[model samples]
Target chain A: MKADTRSGTGDPMDGFDTTIHAPNRLRICALLDTAGEAEFAVVQEQLDVSASVLSKHVTVLMEAGYVEQRKAVRNTRQRVWLRLTPGGRQAYQAHLAALRAIVGP
Target chain B: METDEAIRPTPQQARATLAELERVQASTAALSATPWPRWFATVLTLYIAAIPPVYGGMTASTQWLLPKSAWSTVLVLATAGYLALFAFAAATWRKKTGVALRLDVLPKRATLPLAIGLPALLIGAVVAFRSTGQPAWLFAASGIGAAVSIAFHRAFVRLHRKTA
Candidate 1:
């Protein structure tokens, strides 16, 4: 498929970012965009993916500055929470719009 | 003949990926809706139902059915219990949902009606109370409040299911 030349800013197809195009990463962003924040175990459970697989995808998103993590103590146990940053949300939404554009308006 | 082997998405592949994303998002929304908010609304409806009987001050004949002191005590305890239940429900909701609840995921079309309709119902309650000098009018208000809360909750759940 030919890459659309219209810039991602003006035309969503133009903004197709490679970093967020991976299947797991896309799923992570989609979930985070809706949940706002979710515990690591919860995300893994929902995705039905192994913790290692989730961790790898999360690392990729985090490296791209699209995802953020926080730590909290719950029930006397330390837990990690994940959420999309504002930038990540924008990127993910744009990617969705780009997908729609490709699919047909 | 050799074929180009580098993996790339065709428009059909892009469309399929988009559909899968939509399916995942829909599932996320369904899971995100949780039951906590509905439970909270149910308890709130009960609390609202208690308001008229407790606060409107019983009629003279009605007061004669139970000693005023005992009646007031029961009302106070019931009110306290309802409030405690609300707090418990809210906390459980927060924990069970795995995050702070996000009503923002609900379509604006779904929320806009609730935002407008609830206050409208309350205002109508006030109008009814003012127009008719009957304190019993409050019971109707409480009933409507409870019903509306439940309806709004159901509407949200239904919308989530339909969209999903």
Candidate 2:
């Protein structure tokens, strides 16, 4: 393996770094960034994506250390909650700031 | 001791913090996680019941704005066209936002509104008691239409969720 770059780099976002973040991932990050934390159901509902598709994208983000997911029973129903890690938040905010700067007048 | 430091919220800082809070609230509203079905029922009940009396008041107030027949015709047609356009818009918005219209529009939704929804139904009742020959059943019908819309809404939510 290429030094498991995620573990090797001490940078907050070393593992989660991406040169070409896809639209869906970016959308997820934007939604998560603003919401702080959210339920899988709600996220799926807003994004209008299939559960499997969302799960796949979320898994990629999780693998990249950009997300955290937890499972629990709420009101006798199984629910999944998600929040971004500090590294995830930092990366998203900086990336967003950079994008805004790029589009600045 | 009394001449202590002044703790003040600078206008610019207060505005920035308020702006951030409003943004967070809006985002949470967009992503409200409550089941769309219940949200649908509650919202449709409240608004369908609430809107007609206001429209009627507007219609009555504006009666002298034109002749009765012409005015009523224009008003009814305008409102109907607007409602249809609104329904179309809501459906399209449901597609775009990936949630039921009601759920997509509110912050921290709950089912308590359905009980309150009944009172909203009686707004037309109160209007009927005040006005002569008002079609009180119109209110009932409105409530029924709202419930029916919930069915369509749930389907859209489920379908959108599947396709998204």
Q: Highest lDDT: which candidate? A: 1
Query: Largest DockQ belongs to which candidate?
Result: 1
Every prediction's TM-score for the first chain?
Answer: 0.88, 0.77
The lDDT, on a scale of 0 to 1, for candidate 1 is 0.72
What lDDT is reached at residue B25 by model 2? 41
* TM-score, cand. 2 vs. native: 0.36
Query: What TM-score did chain B of candidate 1 earn?
Result: 0.61
Over the stretch A9-97, how does candidate 2's per-residue lDDT look in tens digits? 35322322342145566667766766666678878866679999999999988987889987766559887877788888866654443
The sequence of per-residue lDDT tens digits that candidate 1 reaches over residues B32-61 is 776546556777777666555444443323
For candidate 2, the iRMS in Å is 15.7
Evaluate model 1: give its TM-score.
0.75
Best by TM-score: 1
Which 10-residue window of candidate 1 chain B scores lowest in summed lDDT?
B1-10
lDDT of 2 by residue, B25-50 (tens): 45555443333445435555455544
